[model samples]
Target: MSADARERGRIVVGVDGSESSKDALRWAVRQAELTDSTVDAVTAWEYPPLYGSIGWIDAPQELAGDIKGAASRALNHAVKEAVPPDQTARVHCGLAYGTPAAVLLDQARGADLLVVGSHGHGGFAGALLGSVGQHCTQHAPCPVVVVRG
Candidate 1:
C-alpha cells in the first residue's frame, strides 16, 4: 500500500441489510471515490438464546449456522448493490457474531473513518440515531459519520 493508502483512507461502514444502512454504504462509497479510499462494509449477527426459551424446537448449531449465513449474505448483497462496478474492487465485506456497535468499533481500529446509518432495525427504529450509530460516535477510535436516511 502507498503511504497515503496506509494513512487515513480506510473507511469502515456498518451495515444491517436495512435501508438506512444502504444509505450509509452509498455515502461511504462516494467518499471513498473522492479520497481514493477503500471501504469495508461490516454486518453483525448473533443467535438469540431465547429461541429455545419460548419452547421453539430447533437445533442450536443449525440455528447458529443459518443466522451467520444470512448475515454474510446480507453483507455481500448490500456491498454489491451500493458499490459501483468500477469501485467494487475497493470495497470489502465483513460479517461477525457480536453486537453491531461492538463489531463496528472493533473494525474501526486504525481506520480513517467509521460510517453508520442514523437508524436501523432496532428497538428505537424511529429514533434519530440507533444504538450502533450512537455507540460508534461515542467510542470509535476514528471520526464517525452517521448517514441519515
Candidate 2:
C-alpha cells in the first residue's frame, strides 16, 4: 500500500451476497473514489450449529472448509457484481471466520469509515436495518454509512 493511500485512510464494507450488501459495497466504492481512499470488502462466515439426539454435535472439518469457501466465493462475486471493472483495483477482498458484525467491527478498528447494508439475508423483510447493520452502527470504532438496497 502506498503512503498516500494510507494517508487517505480505508473504508470497510460488509458484503453478505445480498442485494442490500451489494448496494453498500457500491456505495463504499463510490465514497472511496471521491476520497481517494482504499476499500476493504469483507465477508464473514462461521460453522453452522449442529445437533444430534444426544446433544450438540461438532461440525465436520470438511463442512467448515466448504462454508469458508462459499463465503470467499460470495465475497468475490459480490465485488464483481457491485464494483465496476475499472475501479476494482481500489477494492481489496477479505474473508473472516466470525459473525458479520464482529468481523466488520474488527476490520474497522482504524478505518476512516464503515459501511453496511440496511438489511442482509437474515432479517425481517420490512425492517429498516438488519441486525448486523444495527450492531455495527452501534459498536463500530469509526463512523458508519448504512446503504439501502
Candidate 3:
C-alpha cells in the first residue's frame, strides 16, 4: 500500500456511468483534493450463471467481458475524465459484484466519507433520491453525501 492509502482512509463514491454519477465523480475529485483523501469510485455488478453450469460456477466469459467493459469505460470517465486534472492521481475506481446499496454500504466501512448520486441512469424523474441512494443513506457506516445532478 502507498503512503496515501495509509492516511485517513478515502472518499468512496459510487459510479454507474450515469450523468448524475459522473457529476458526483467530478465533485468527489474536488473533495478529495481539498481533503487530501483518495476517491474510491465503485460500480457494483451481478452476473447471472452461465449456461449448463451450476449456480456456484465461476462467472461466464460474456459476463466477465461485460464486467470488464463496464469497469473500463467507467474508470476512464469517472477517474480520468470526471475527475479534475489536479486530482487525477488521488482518484481510483474499483468494480465489484452485488447490489449497489450493499456494495456501497460495505465499501463505506473503510471510507472517511461516502458520496452517492441522487438520480440514477435509469431512474424516473420523480425520485429525488433513487432507491440505491436511499438505501445507502439508511445503511451507510459513514456520513453520506447524496449529490443531485
Candidate 4:
C-alpha cells in the first residue's frame, strides 16, 4: 500500500459470471489502475438457507457445500477472466450471501466506487441498467458505476 492506497477507497464490482458482469469487471479493473485503487470483485450468491430465512430448515447437507463452491468458483473465474496478468496483483475477490442488490449495497459502505453490469438474468436488452445496478446507484454510500454492455 502506497500513500494513495491508504487514501484511496475500494472499487467494487458485482459479478455473477455473466458476459455483462465481465464487462463491468473489466471496466472496474481499469478504474482501479488509473485511480490507484484496488479491485474488490464481488459476487453475492444466495443459498437455500437464505431462501428459508423465515425459519424453514432441513435443506440437504450438500446444499451449503454446493452453493459455497459455486460462489467461490465464480468469483475466482471472474477475476481470472476480467483482470489481466499484470493487473492481477491489484485484484481482490469476495463472495457473500443475500441478493445482488443488497450485497453490493452493503459493500458500498467502504468503497469509493461500486460497479455493476447493466443486465443480469432478469434484465431486458437496452435497459441501460439492471435492477441491481439501479439499486446500487441509488443506495450506495459512494459513487456507482453501471457498466453498460
Best by lDDT: 2
> Per the 3 Å backbone cut-off, how many clashing residue pairs does candidate 4 have?
0
Candidate 3, backbone clash total: 0
lDDT, model 4, position 98 = 82
Local lDDT at 148 for model 4: 71
Off by over 4 Å in 4: 1-4, 48-58
Q: Give lDDT per model, in order.
A: 0.87, 0.93, 0.81, 0.84
TM-score of 2: 0.95
Query: What 10-residue stretch in candidate 4 is worst by lDDT?
Result: 47-56
- TM-scores, each model vs. reference: 0.88, 0.95, 0.83, 0.85
Candidate 3 global lDDT? 0.81
Among all windows of 10 consecutive residues in model 2, the one with the lowest summed lDDT is: 1-10
lDDT of 4 at 81: 84
Clashes found in each candidate (C-alpha, N, C closer than 3 A): 0, 0, 0, 0
- Writing each residue's lDDT as its tens digit, candidate 3 over 47-82 gives 755555444665666677777677668667766658
- Model 1: per-residue Cα lDDT over 66-127, one tens digit each: 89998989888888777789989888888877889889999999899999999887757457
lDDT score, residue 18, model 1? 90
After superposition, the stretches of candidate 2 with alpha carbons farther than 4 Å from their true spots are: none
Positional deviation of 117 in candidate 2, in angstroms?
0.2
Best by TM-score: 2
Using TM-score as the measure, name the better of candidate 2 and candidate 4. 2
Stretches of candidate 3 above 4 Å error?
Answer: 2-4, 48-61
